[model samples]
Target: MQTPLQFCPRCKKDVAFVAAAGARTCPECGFQYAVSEPPNPGSFPDRPDRAGNPWLQFLTIAGIVVLALLGAGALLLGILFVGCALAFRG
Candidate 1:
């Protein structure tokens, strides 16, 4: 059996190519059909683990150091408050 020719949605005429290659331009009405893949509906892991760039690694380390310094400062403040309370009690 012969395959039926695919019709262009705009002009209702047979399309040139079977698989939508490039833009589908309608000869009759000059309507342009945009050729794009359908979106993948399934969720998938976007990130893959690998050795990152050296500059990126350095920035990440710098961020970690800043966070650690903030945590240390909070701990030091708590210790100073406790020591001040003990000294006042004496």
Candidate 2:
């Protein structure tokens, strides 16, 4: 079921509604018209699903913290081991 075309305000030409566009230009006179939906009492278009998952958010933060701590610990251990080796050699 296709929606009806809207009339161009400038030239009164019929302009079809584009799904992703807000306004369309008239083919006849190049006049722009705002796309409007037909009045339906109980019509709901497909809406984007909410990206709401509590566990996913918690796991992402935990993973970042673990990686940061591991990286810092590894760096500190490397520095300490190298310093101890150099001191013993001297």
Candidate 3:
């Protein structure tokens, strides 16, 4: 089903509600809007599930931390390898 269009307060333009719900960004003015109850009831033809899951949020943070640590470790190892090569050459 297609979602109805909504009016953007900043741009005074009719923007697609489905696109705004997914991105929370206004197509015209680039203004950001929160995905919550519409200011006027029935403004949005349909509501998309915007529920947050705690486990997913935790895993996302954990994944980012793991990636950062791995990147740092790789950088340190690269520096050490270069230093060892230069020292042995001297």
Model 1 lDDT, residue 71, Cα = 97
Clash totals, every prediction: 0, 0, 0
For model 3, the stretches where C-alpha displacement exceeds 4 angstroms are 1-50
User: lDDT per residue, candidate 2, 1-90, as tens digits?
Assistant: 464577767766676634435555666677654546443346534431223456877998999999999999999999999999999999
List, residue by residue over 1-90, the lDDT tens digit for candidate 3.
Answer: 765678888888898743543356776678776865444454554444433456877888999999999999999999999999999999
In the predicted model 3, the residue pairs found to clash are none
RMSD in Å for all candidates = 13.3, 11.9, 11.1
TM-scores for the candidates: 0.39, 0.45, 0.46
Tens-digit lDDT track of model 1 for 16-71:
53323445466566777665534234542143122435688899999999999999
Q: lDDT of each structure? A: 0.63, 0.66, 0.72
**Comparing 2 and 3 on TM-score, the stronger one:** 3
Model 3 CA lDDT for position 75: 100
